[model samples]
Target: MSGEDFEDALKYTLQRKGWKLSTTKKTGDFGADLIGHDPKGRKVVIQAKRWNSKVGVDGVNQVIAAKAYYRADHAMLVTNQYLTNAAFELAKRTGVEVWSRKRLNAEIEANIPSKSNK
Candidate 1:
């Protein structure tokens, strides 16, 4: 999937999870790709990566900077490919959640209505 596809999927998943979603705001320069809010209005900063190869820690660092810059309550890194070990370590250290393709798929599935009922 392309970067845009991943972003779209992320937005869809968030909405399915009952989040209030917004695109990159023009006036607010969070340096992050997307901004979401939970039912209680907690901020969620999302960084997207649709790389053909594994994403390294640099991408994670960039998003981390954006998270601090934005003062978000929580941050997530969503990628089509897997994150490197260094990236995982960086995310763990920075309190950013890393969601790989498999994780994303599972989350999407869990949020969706059961096929048997639907």
Candidate 2:
């Protein structure tokens, strides 16, 4: 999917799972693609990426700033592609949740039943 499509799809997927989320403006979003509250009502900021290549430290870095800019309690970088080792390390160290393809799919499946299941 294209980058914009991926962001919208991710937002829809999360909403299907009952998360209250809002998409940020395309410009001047301050690095946040989506903003919302988690289950415990803590604010969250997310940066969504759809890339063929492994996501790098830039993605993690963006979310780091997004959390601070949004004054969020948590930050997440969700992507259809996995992260680079360096990005992974940075995310772990900086408390940015990196939701790689596997994690993203898991969250999708949590609420979206497959057609095969019927």
Q: Write the per-residue lDDT of candidate 1 for residues 1-118, one digit (tens) a residue.
A: 6566667777887887789877785445455778868677888888888788988998788788777887889888888789889998999998988888798778878877777976
For model 1, what is the alpha-carbon lDDT of residue 24? Answer: 82
Query: How many collisions per candidate?
Result: 0, 0
Candidate 1 — which pairs collide? Answer: none
Give, for candidate 1, the lowest lDDT window spanning 10 residues. 23-32
**Predicted candidate 2 versus true structure: per-residue lDDT over 1-117, tens digit per residue:** 778888888888887767789999999988899999877787999999888899999889888999999899999999998999999999999989888999998887787867898
Query: lDDT of all the models against the reference?
Result: 0.80, 0.90
Candidate that would win on TM-score: 2
For model 1, the local distance difference test gives: 0.80
